[model samples]
Target: MKKVNYLDKFLLKVFILFVFFGSLYANDHPYIIVLGTAQDGGSPHAACKKDCCEELWDNRFLHKKVSSIAIVNPKDKKFWIIDATPDFPEQLDFLEKKTGFSLAGIFITHAHMGHYTGLLHLGREVMGSKNVPVFVMKKMKKFIESNGPWSQLVELKNIALKELSNEQFISLSTNLYIKPILVPHRDEFSETVGYQIKSKKSLIFIPDIDKWSKWSYDIRDVVQKNDYNLLDGTFYNINELPGRDMSKIPHPFIVETMELIEKDKNKVFFIHLNHTNPALKQNSLEHKNILKKGFNITKFGQKFHL
Candidate 1:
């Protein structure tokens, strides 16, 4: 039998203390998890024969869901999702399996199909969730309450709409806050807004903004204030969609956004990529360029401590 030394005992105690504090720190802070990264139509878009999506049709593993993210509090066993997308069912299941937490609530960015349409899952025919608090802006609240299918969700008590005022911070949990900042977009049904989530650190999400110049607030200032920024990357550049008018479906191209914030490129993660966007291909030159330039591309399941 080997005899244990005083030094071994001291090392054992140090290791135990490290493990104890690590667990406590993880539980004390909330984090953001990326659920999906595709645009509203999703990857391998319907009725498309483009080269970018053609290979994805046969590759089930390559499919990307609509853009969405989840915030999780391990301490309380609660989590919240931003932008209940068409992929809500799978996203919800992923969160449940990943964290085993109850959904705290959902936050919607706008009335866009990819943003708010997933509330349908909580209706009578599906989960039939009871009073699932859905946070939204003023026009968004009215849009849901007044619409047919969405109104039915409200009437059946599947969801409880909570209106959020622009730039006002709302408390989600201890040391956790969320603020909505209105942005310029094609607000056909409701106004669009970006969310700023604060925990140990802050993160900014602007997945569908039309263009940075159109907004009153400076994009560079916003990027600097937040630890992480997931901005719109619907197209790699203005020439992505040929024959189709790019002006009508405007978004700050990846190149344009990159040029805007040269210094803080490390803090930015471009997301909500369209099928035609070459950056969606991991090995493509555009994707490589993004990383080479100190910027990042958001991927499904990426976790960031907040």
Candidate 2:
């Protein structure tokens, strides 16, 4: 009887510790949390029936949301999301429950589907949230205003679109500002931009860009200026999408990027990974190599005190 009681006490202590530390995740004030890291299509890409997506398909727990992040000021219990992805519902839910915070606004990098499509949730068809401030570039604002359902959201006053410009800094709260920088990417629908986020720590998030060479600014300079770079790591190498003509949709391959800014390894936290990338696979060579090189891989649900 004494032995059994001792074992039970040990188990109970472990459970309490787990919950306590888990709650501290978002409870840490003025922090940033990675909401998701998968690309636009997310893991288990549409129409894919491969082993890569099999486990996620079989178990919802294994599923990954599109790339997104949240900055929370727990002192005020308010938060903002970067790139409201298609997984906004779940992401917002996680933020609210974990941080005990309310959504103050959303900052968008581009008009890509995964980036802003989740704005639909704030529409009358869903949450019908009133006056949700959506910050965007001028073209991004026009893109939303000129569109159909998105325009309807503006019409219904579900969201108010605020335009930002290159190098423009908009204050979210005290010392928390979003600085937008233009980057080259496909712009059939809207202009593309990345954000230089100011919180407890500075972060640069460029989810989709043509290549490092195409940018007006040096990648190394940008990484050096910011404490964290949630950079574009969509594909591991040139051969990631076989026969897909990658040049048509150019992005700096992960391997190429790693070589380009090898000296800034410590600040590089690769994000916006596609399901096709082997780095997303657990214990893969690419994943191990990144860590071995003194770089970090941004995982879904990881938080950094900002």
Candidate 3:
């Protein structure tokens, strides 16, 4: 190699940064990237002895992280996450690598262990991230403020809780905004919500919810309004859980959801699948049926420009 000058090195560094961030800020806009698609316990369900993990036991390659998505604004080198799942560490790493930005904030959907537990990783005991904005609804704000380790994260300012009203918009930039809509679900600790992220094209992210009939808003209306909808797909059917009162879990079955939708299935994507859901397997009939119906099941690392 030939000798390089001082200015050459500086320009090269700038070019490298621009190229890295360019992946996210393409066309002067950002994109929404999928991080994980599994339910609370993740795809393996730690205690599961079911055939779901029969071929995947101790197989990290076959595992799926809990459901989460990242909104990247490479122009600002900022990112916002929806739900900090148990796999936050891996998800964050993937997003950072894909977008070349640090996490600027987090927007939690609810208080489920799968949804908010990753906030603990950002607290004093772990990464110790500073002043990361965690947007939430009223009850969620109270729940975090009143809880133990989560409360400490607040006091230490590891994360800041920003209260949001239902249907209110949180503008991230000139082109980007997020709207939270309250949805009915098992609200043991805090209210559940689905978010509408609007940029070039709008997208709805609802990783978890009760049955479609239970929600006040029509699923049809939601799909009609947004460019893309990633709704809950916790189980393939009620029979997935052998003897348990499956009704207690409350998520809409994939088949039931497929039957419920009347619009373009391409606009609808099912996510937050439990480990027992055979639809996760590419070769499985359930997966083929989902595609046959024209709907999609989100896979880790799937990117949707918005």
Candidate 4:
């Protein structure tokens, strides 16, 4: 070996330190946790006098507001929320406790009340955040800009809207990317979308869809392409909601979804459950059957390392 000088030894030590820190930073992966799994109105919905709502009121059950998730990037100590549901305050508190107090951004999938209405909390009356970035679709961007309470948030500079394109990827870090996929749903105010979140491990989220068969796209194809699929499971059966017309409110029933995904084992996890759906109960027959069939019913506080 050649003789090493003091300057050469110093340079080698600095280079080694740089390489070690770089590897440590590169190895950190983002994590996600499901905060809620109910539909837009959520379990124990407003004006709902059903047994489910009663149970929640009496503290027998603790159903959350709606389906939403928290994505934590440990490397940056940043937290991202997907879908700002009515239960945002509680969700934020939960997130704050689980991960430190650092909210990076909020990604909205659509203009539905359950999905994006919680942006109100960021307004002057609440956190009064200065230019909190909100990632949304083009139409949703316009909708928020023109709407009343949402528009006020924009005018006050509480939230800065960032338009997202369908099927286009938004990179949060070298190891994490989120792509939005357009889905067919009630477009009374704005279009609907599902997200394909790619980390070292990818996960698909399709919270609300009109009907899988009616859509021009193939849901199965999307599931086959992703590592984990968190699909729409709004109802357990067609007649789940007693008084409502099942045809008007379209979603893939748990039974039908199970049948459709029977062949593809260990990939599907059903979410976005309605209050009427018995699958929400931990000990329910529906829940047991789903687990037995290699399907999972998404529960609040469930974490997935990505």
Leading candidate by TM-score: 1
Ranking by TM-score: 1, 3, 2, 4
Q: How far does residue 128 in candidate 3 sit from its true spot (Å)?
A: 1.5
Q: lDDT per residue, candidate 4, 230-292, as tens digits?
A: 899999998778888998888888888777764565778888888878888787898898899
lDDT of 3 by residue, 98-189 (tens): 77788889999999999999999998789988999999999999999998978999999999899999998889988899999998899999
| Model number with the top lDDT | 1
The better-scoring model by lDDT among 2 and 4 is: 2
Q: TM-score of predicted model 1?
A: 0.96
Residue-by-residue lDDT tens digits, candidate 2, 1-306:
999999999999999999998888646447788999999999978877876786678778767789988888876789899888989999999989987779999989888889999999999889999999999988899989998989999999999888888998888777677788999999988889888878767988898999999999999998998888899988889888887999997889988888888577889988888888889876789999888888888988887777
Ranking by lDDT: 1, 3, 2, 4
Poorest 10 consecutive residues by lDDT, candidate 3: 1-10
TM per candidate comes to 0.96, 0.89, 0.91, 0.89
In Å, residue 122's CA in model 4 sits off its true spot by 0.3
Q: Runs in model 2 with CA error above 4 Å?
A: 1-29
lDDT of prediction 1: 0.93
Cα-based lDDT for every prediction? 0.93, 0.87, 0.89, 0.86
